[model samples]
Target: MSPATQAMQREDTQNPAMLWIANGQQLWHTAPKDSNGKSCAACHSDAKESMRSKAAGFPRFSAPAGKVITLSQQINQCRSNAQQAAALPQESAELLALEAYVALQSRGLPVSPSRDPQTRQAAARGQKLFTTRIGQLNLSCAQCHDNNAGKRLAGALIPQGHANAYPIYRLEWQGVGSLQRRLRNCMSGVRAEVPPYGAPDLVDLEAYLAQRAQGMPMETPGVRP
Candidate 1:
């Protein structure tokens, strides 16, 4: 990141993403006005304690759903099955804030996704997606992240593209964003057909990212350029 970007990330006062965090904290405790009215706090009580290290293992298998689900998906599931509240849109601001807030609870912890048999297969599929060239540019994730990391592309340096520093405050984006959002951005960059928010490929790809970055510390609500 450039010097200005680095400085913005260092403190909440300089970080715009903190605005979302404040809203997320409120959502965590405010009960929805619905039939199964309940806030996340109603069940978990306190986030910092109950949610500790949970985000680090996310994008994991959901036996009930028969596939891996993201932290946002799991949160939505709770709203439906447990609280009977209307679900938030996949990439809505409210959802992002809530997701960021929850993810922040697991900050600094290592990502430790499950290594179940099904997950292994999914991870392999994700690897295929990462390596396979797509889009008009015909680029794969590996070409930039694996092959050309630490090099500049269109005036920006390409990092390893790991998912660890997610729910991040990107200077270019000017807001908090999740790993899935970043993937979509990459897809668009390649001129590839961007997948829908909860598409199977996206889910599988997220699982693979978490696995690839296994043991990397979570940098929830991280800042980036």
Candidate 2:
């Protein structure tokens, strides 16, 4: 295998985010009284059976929302509607674990984000967002991750903005987070005020990232520096 791919593999094995995934597995089977006394397993059966190869497609256009939605958003929706559980705050351990578990189901599947009309439009918007300068730094995501990918910035190698692997354990964050959350971190890095989770702009950006990684295999539960 090429060095970069080999390095990425090594990173995954060493990722601490796997611990959160393990936690999520435990949570999934734990019954909650507030959830109508139901466990996630009740409706989903086995996580492998119900969710296998499912997370490979994300940032999907939700007809109900009239916009693209990330995998994390969908998990929250499921918690509210299917599991009868209260929606946890975004970036919480409960949400992260659930997302990690779902993402793991699609491990090794190719990212197949939609090409539907809505998604296409969202992707277009996202591309613009990627290149547009935002925040106090007046820098775009491409400024580092794209234009200077593989180069060093303050002692870190800039990745090529690949979102195929997500629900990753980031050493910096010291926890698991979604690609969208990472996008927000970039916005913050540039001193830009981040939009709310599930915000249209962020959703579009996710759609664009997933579409860019069209044929890339899903590496959910990835570990990143």
Candidate 3:
């Protein structure tokens, strides 16, 4: 990103993602409509205290789900199991807002994906997917993110493809988006078959990314051009 874009992210007032974060804060304290469901705050209490460093350890095994899941998935699980509410749809404004709000609590903390067997296995599958060629272009994620990182592609810089900064305010999208959205964009760019949102494959890839980005500081609500 350019200096100006970086500055936009660093300053909360200038960051567009702050809007989502604010909405998320409101939702955290707001009860579900048409139901006796409790607000997120009712169960978790103060997010700053209860959710601190929580985002760092995502893409972990969920005993209830019996699989590895992302932060967003976990949030939905909490809503369903604890709040007795319906799970929010992927990439929905409300969901993204909640995710952004939760992720914000872990900003500047190190990425710390679980080392459990199931998570590790998912990461292994993701690693294989990362290296395997696919799509009309016959390209792999490693080709651009690993081999050609820092190189120019269609007038844009090819980043190292880290998952540290997410739920970012992408100028291209004109809104906050999740890592899975970004992955879908890449698949489309490569002319590959795009998977549906919340697919296990995407979650597995996220687990791999989390492991790859381990120890990197979280940069939720990041801005990207």
Relative to the true structure, how large is the alpha-carbon lDDT of every model? Answer: 0.87, 0.81, 0.93
Task: Pull out the clashing pairs in model 3.
Answer: none
Global fold similarity of model 2 (TM-score)? 0.89
Off by over 4 Å in 3: none
Candidate with best TM-score: 3
Question: What's the candidate order when arranged by decreasing lDDT?
Answer: 3, 1, 2
Q: Give one digit per residue, the lDDT tens place, for model 2 in 20-136.
A: 888889888986556877788977889998888778878787765566777778876777777677878888888889889888888888988887888889899999999999999
User: Candidate 2 — what's its lDDT?
Assistant: 0.81
lDDT of 1: 0.87
Model 3, poorest ten-residue lDDT window?
30-39
Candidate 1 structure, TM-score to reference: 0.95
| Model 3 clashes, total count | 0
Model 3, position 177, has a per-residue lDDT of 97
C-alpha positional error of residue 78 in candidate 3 after TM-score superposition, expressed in Å: 1.0
* Alpha carbon deviation, residue 23, candidate 1 (Å): 0.8
